[model samples]
Target chain A: MLTYEPDETVAHALDPRAKLAFQVAFAVAAISRPALAPLGVLSLLALGVLLSANLSPPRVLFGYRYPFGILCLSVLIAAVTIGPPWIDLADGVRTAHAAYGVGLVLLVSAAYVRSTPVRHSRAAIQSLVPGTPGRLLGIGVSLVFRFVPVLRRDIGTIRDAMAARLGTERSATERAVVLSSRGLTRAFVRADRLSVALQARCFAWNPTLPPLSFARADGLVLLLSVVLVTVPLW
Target chain B: MSTDHEYDSVALVPESIVRPFARAALLAALTGAVAFVSIPIPFSPAPLTLQVLFVFLAGLYLGPVWGSVSLLLYLTAGGAGAPIFAGGHAGIGHLFGKTGGFLWSYPIAAFVIGALVHGRTGFGFGSIDPTADETPSGGFFDSLEVRDPATVGLGRLVVALSVGTLIVYAIGAGYAMWLLSLSPVEAVAQFVAPFVIGEVLKMAATIALVRDGRYELS
Candidate 1:
């Protein structure tokens, strides 16, 4: 449920491209160097990112509870053995260390998600990858953003209608078929209308898009990303 | 009202591309929408979801190229913060997280399913009109025709979906094993064993949808 919110925070003002680069660098660094001291430093950087975006650590942690839980369970699984020594403490610790590194990477990504808008991300993608393929992806992504809610509503209505007709009594496969069949039909109908609308409005391969430019702060962010990527080398 | 004033500057997307592109985007959105509809299994820690069903249908409906394209769009949108990942988690992190293998396998699984079902590449839109045998014109729109999913034999459909399912599990478990430092046995125990029943059920549902023929691309 953590999504981009309109805010005047530092992370929000930075260029999405810079944030994306920083995230990739952070993940690489965290994964490549999973030692305790390096992980501790990365954790602090992740905290800085979360704070800059005005995201609460507890809230982000709660959002990712399921994956985190699985990570924790893996540690236990790593420890268990069937031999005389019954448990491998070193293996458990190693697994936990890797999981912690992954956790920090997730935290950095949560900040990016909280601060960057879909339009900004789309613009960044279009500018990052040039030509017709980029244009298709940019426009295609925007269309997806525009339609997920509408289709979600359609699915909801279908589910409700099925429930009203005592469709819950049916087998699981029967219910799934009914729901998906109705969902696909509605989606195809909507797509047909949407295609007509696009043609009517003269959907072009090259249209003027909202501009995005990297400011001075983004330069510093990019520098930080570069430094993070070089941490393993050092 | 000059007929030639800047009209040529606007390169409009042709109708042939527009229709499939719209359907692809919508299908991607539908994939996201259905992630919210999870059905909890009795003993398994992971719940069964319709995400895979949509992936299968994506291939069966859109053919290889567009089917993969649709899934690529879904992954990008989710990575950019759509609350569409399992349990509504989003961000680029999920793309590289422990379950990232499964997320990454989607497009490939869809592509495999589509290729096996359609029996040819090129989006399965290569003018399959049996009545008209004029070596169909080569333009984008002229050679295009939406093939009916029902036209595919049942055995092919089942085989395609089974292979798709195997690819998903293979990649998913392989990646998890590497990332989580689990033994292969542990990975299968954790990732693959629990979901067998749900996968079969989803395959059945997808097969039924194709057989029903109610949602033809045309």
Candidate 2:
């Protein structure tokens, strides 16, 4: 089970609404910039955000590498496919560099979310969808966290079962059959159980109830988000 | 934790009150699953998704209040860095990224749909006595019984869903135009035209499935 531990310094400090607003504003502003310099600055600020939250380099690296891979692919695609379709070295580098700038902005934004708690993230959403009941929102947050570990265990179980069934002499078709039948069934059964549990708990929407509050940290975050968006426009 | 203890807890609730919430959450997840049918859209960040169909279905199934709440829950999960987006990518930024308009409009779209279908004049599922062959049951009893499709037609339900879906498209198009800095006509040409055919097909399917009682069940 993945324990629900909120980081006091980072997660607890900011208002969920404020964090969401700031993130949205920053994402819009950062992605719109044509030049790499602004995004490069934002990438550095993502590092600063990690430092402020006291998150380790390894954690930051974990979220960033896939985006970097995407960035590489986007840049290569832009370089090879766009603008005159030439094999010229200079043109290739230029298009690739522009694509890299867009990718960098995307990477920084992902890092920000990774370092934040999932609960606060949900809170920001609550701010957007007016008349959302508090209990339903809370249950939704809980279910997302709850399901992750359940999914992880099911995957592990499937892998172990597959290994056991696939003896040294097993053919490829037999191995495929074992994986699809045993593994898929295990996953489906777990999902069905989860649905039944949720139903039993009376987890429907209660519209009259209000969502959780946004605190002082949320105000600061909102301010930062506004500044982030306006800075580019100015 | 034990099986006996879990069943004991489950046995306590009256089925009517408990059934709705369970049904709502399940429907929302199913709605998300339905939205995944659209693959590549050829152009535009917005894929031609079954999202509107399910959004309408959620409103119709959960009534006005819970239907909207389910949409909120789905958005919260997507915004919170779950890989549940089109082609499976997530983060708060995705809500503001190139395809931000569709993400932003979901809740409002759901609310409008729900509000349109927010009442029950009658009930379904064997509530009506099938063997009521007593010449319209005199006078007072006639008022209580369902009078077939003429009384509770599916057309009203389809109209309600369409209005809600239109609200989504309006918000989505408006946001896309502003974000992209395109003229109003240009935005419609680029963003709206591509998805029109698919959206119409989804609406027809949603109406057919909803009328057949494919909704409401877990």
**Predicted structure with the largest lDDT when compared to the true one:** 1
Model 2 regions more than 4 Å off: A1-22, A25-106, A117-132, A144-233, B1-19, B34-36, B39-48, B119-152, B213-218
Report the error of model 1 at residue B96, Å.
0.8
Encode model 1's per-residue lDDT on A51-169: one tens digit a residue.
Answer: 99999999999988888998888788787876869898887887778778788888899999989999999988888877767777888888888888899999999889988999877
lDDT of 1 at A174: 80
Maximum-TM-score candidate: 1
TM-score of 1: 0.92
* Per-candidate TM-score, chain A: 0.95, 0.68
Model 2 Cα lDDT, one tens digit per residue, B1-218: 32343333322222332344444454444444433344333344545555566576666555555566666666666666655555445566556543567767767776666655554422223212212232323322223211222123577767876787677778776765554444466456555776776566566655555444422232
The lowest-lDDT stretch of 10 consecutive residues in candidate 2 chain A is A172-181
- State in Å the error of residue A102, model 2: 8.6
**Candidate 1 colliding pairs:** none
Task: State residue B101's C-alpha deviation in candidate 2, in Å.
Answer: 1.9
Interface RMSD (Å) of candidate 1: 4.0
RMSD of each: 4.7, 11.6
The worst-scoring run of ten residues by lDDT in candidate 2 chain B lies at B141-150
